[model samples]
Target: MNEQDDDRDGGCGAGCGCGTPGREQFVSISRPSDAPSTAGAGATDRHTIEQAVIPAGTFVMGDSSGDRNAGDGEVPLHEVTLGSFSIDATSVTNDDFARFVDATGYATEAETFGFSAVFHLALAAPEEDILGQPPGTPWWFGVKGADWRHPGGRNSSLAGLGDHPVVHVSWNDVQAYCDWAGRRLPTEAEWEYAARGGLDQKKYPWGDEEPDAGGTWRANIWQGGFPGTNTLEDGYLTTAPVRTFEPNGYGLWQPIGNVWEWCADWFDPNYYRASPAANPTGPIRGGSRILRGGSYLCHISYCNRYRNSARSQNTPDSSMGNAGFRTVSR
Candidate 1:
């Protein structure tokens, strides 16, 4: 990556993959525990996660559309072959996480850190719970008591959000969830392959058509002015239910938009230049982990990465309201 590219990546922290800014002021330096928990041994029994079984296939990976982010290493589109795998039909929901937490007694990194990134407009806690905002991005605030349960802050609860994809989960937290559920995050290549949904290099899972084709919204994305005014044209100001949109050919729902989903790969913009054609996992080591599928905050003017081949990265321990993850069978 070039100097300017480095600056752009640094500007947006954990949540910026979906347009939510990161908290640079309060960096989460300490890593969370990765030990597997014996609890939740019957997690599969409690929640029968619907998974889409993608047959082994080869498809071009990376962006062919001109919408690719500059310097995001989405260039030099290459063919990738992946083996058959089963992935959750939708992003992990609040109910799923709640079961894991209740069984394992696990505390997400955000809960351990005592604060997490929350969009300014979505702030639901008392003024005292508001910590501060990052330097460049004023729309994000570091709010205390903001985790998966209290997504909007201390006052927020998962009362009506049981089906919504769980937010405020860090990459490390996902590890715990996977450990309990006996699953793993999909590789970036696997994610893109399934996200394509049998289509070849299409801009979206459905097609190259715009998200709002013929005045009908396909995915949940920012409909109006970003950060300032959201007209709610897409029927939601924030995240919609995990299964809100139409399923792709592979029966995956909302693969491109709604919330940024975590991937099992360390990011390297230049890795694609030398990536193996068959089942390429990211780099051997890197500071940040991969985040795919931009969220509702995405707009064409800013962070328009809500596409099949778009990519973003953040530190493993950072958590925010617009990011979550789905899992593949181990």
Candidate 2:
């Protein structure tokens, strides 16, 4: 199917052709033990993956009249039907990822490349120099020793950040984790539906009102100028605990902020036009995969796509400071 066809239903489409460069090639990453027995632990224990029961039903998928800045790709609100399934209630955290890495010895894209791009604002020094930087988005710098474990590179550790959503993961890394855990990434439709928490066409997981409701914060997004200034008004200078913010109606945490979660579908800007209205899996074949949920770096000035309906794309091998994932099962 064409990109326009997939875009019609909130699945990744136009820019995700299968032949595109950097699409991930799946590799086996060994699974760790089941879920942690205790709640609110300093580190996430490997608990059995919890499945969210998304009852078979329909919900409005996009924006048409509201959100003036909503991209053309997210146009023409449509209906989508999904089957019942369970999803992880929280985004994968650093501890959860650490176990996976320890078990498989599987090197991540960032680990293989010896560095990953981190947002300037997330770095201690914005002007720090690094070699072989890629073009575009001057705010992105390649930091050596940066990975899921050391988010900002050397001297960084997940010690206190165990409960926080893991970052610096690529689509390939997410897939490896999913395969090992006997789970799969949610389809784009499934992700958007769960993110909405049963609300229809709301700008965010919570609702249309901006989180700064009368000067109160709702989610963990960038508060001030992006790539430069950060007011840290959200009580977080970086990633917050996965459960730091209030959960959506579906009891899902960090669905709108903290970090972007990778989804199964390949990304194509124009996939929704002719996309199937029921349980769309995205185009059958494509390159870049879809990532949902805005990251802590999200700001209205640059990338405010933290809403349930918001979407973004990434090369399968591209990992960054604000990218990670969750999983689902049938």
Q: Model 2 — TM-score against the truth?
A: 0.82
Looking at model 1, residue 137 earns an lDDT score of 72
User: What TM-score, over all chains together, does every model reach?
Assistant: 0.91, 0.82
For model 1, state the Cα shift of residue 308 in Å: 0.6
Error of 2 at 120 (Å): 2.0
Model 2, residue 217: displacement in angstroms?
A: 0.8
* Highest-lDDT candidate: 1
TM-score for candidate 1, please give it.
0.91
Q: What is the lDDT of residue 295 in candidate 2?
A: 73
Which pairs of residues collide in model 1? none
* Deviation of model 2 at 142, angstroms: 1.2
Best by TM-score: 1
